[model samples]
Target: MNNMKNMKVPSGGAASTLAKLGIIGGIGLYAAANSLYNVEGGHRAIVFNRLVGVKDKVYPEGTHFVIPWFERPVIYDVRARPHLVESTSGSRDLQMVKNWTSSPYSSFAWPATYSLSDPWREL
Candidate 1:
């Protein structure tokens, strides 16, 4: 215990330098981790910048990068989905008429009109 007390600890500059390095390293690590994003299959991504707003470019499936906090990714499922509609009413002859419709719906073409900040707003 007496021998351990004899060892001098870093007093000022060295300690401060280590602290600075640690903070910078932590910030860098966080930025690195946040800068990357992935878009899965059957999905598409759009970039939204804090300053300029949603960009015109769309990212395809796989990995992509953006400025950490300044930009964000909005993902949308573009795969075709089945939709069904059915209606029953009386026709001009007073006879009951039934109608059924099935369609494939997808949002692949609607990204251009979407706004990241206000999802309901049009671009």
Candidate 2:
């Protein structure tokens, strides 16, 4: 018991310093991860800034970077989709007519005057 009393106790200063450093490192890693975005093939992306509205430029396939929390990337699929349309109606001669159509359609050709505020609504 006498020998135990002679031992010195360690201080908490070193542990507190290490904890502060760990917190800072974790925040830095999180910011870095959130700053990058990827656009896959047949897809596109657009930037929306918090301060301003949507950016005018569209990003193609690949990786791009933006400010974390201040800007966001909105990805869109521009690939063509197949659609089938069928209809049945009476002809000018009072005869029954059946129409069947299959075509490839895509929204990528949307007019330039389209609004950027809510792009998803247009789709």
Candidate 3:
């Protein structure tokens, strides 16, 4: 993933030197190199391709745990949401007060897989 573009220098001599030197700016350059020595020039930007390693996420506090890499991919989110509510009920002989809720929002962690095919089940 190398992208090299021809950059125009202010002078013909400078442009020729840069091309003769074969200077590539990292992994991102494009176009035919040394094609033009435009004194009145344009702008050029370089882009690079790279591989980034995944970060290891932390589990909940106060609990000892072991996470196997084979069992999980490292992209689960572990945020928490809360809900609270109040309610009431009554009968002929007695009365009761109740507090209840079903939270509309939730967050939890679940393991993901690198390979998703079922082998034994295929047969």
Candidate 4:
């Protein structure tokens, strides 16, 4: 009891250790959130860099990791997308052009997923 009473406890050690652990935990969480990206179902992801534009590779639906503060991911829906194309007729005749757009992934071939609307001459 006398030795215990005479002993001097070290102050601020536990508090400092807890503070360091809290800071490390916060940094880890931030890094994990920034480094991980989720590509949802029926969707695809493209990796984009801050220094460069869009990356060439397309990631499928899954969880992917990227370098924090260096690269980011852009998600696009690969499902059948709807787009309306408007064309003006040269003559005074009012004609309706019914164009059926196919899906990107289909029997009809396409070079890439991204493309411009082809001029439909057959009205």
Instruction: Count backbone overlaps in model 1.
Output: 0
Off by over 4 Å in 4: 1-12, 82-111, 114-123
TM-scores of the candidates are 0.66, 0.65, 0.21, 0.54
Output the lDDT of residue 28, model 1.
Answer: 99
Note the Cα lDDT for every prediction shown. Answer: 0.79, 0.79, 0.34, 0.69
lDDT (tens digit, per residue) of candidate 1 on 2-35? 9899989976788888999999999999999999
lDDT of 4: 0.69
How displaced is residue 10 in candidate 3, in Å? 20
Which run of 10 residues does model 4 get worst, by summed lDDT?
114-123
Candidate 4 structure quality by residue, lDDT tens digits, 1-123:
899989999888889999999999999999988999898987777776777656667788889999898887777765654444455444457665555554545433323444211111121
**Predicted candidate 2 versus true structure: per-residue lDDT over 49-99, tens digit per residue:** 888768878788999999999999888776666676789999999999999
Q: Best candidate per TM-score, number?
A: 1
The lDDT, on a scale of 0 to 1, for candidate 2 is 0.79
Error of 4 at 52 (Å): 4.4
Q: Is candidate 2 or candidate 4 better by TM-score?
A: 2
Tens digit of per-residue lDDT, candidate 3, span 30-70:
22332222211121111111232232333222322223221
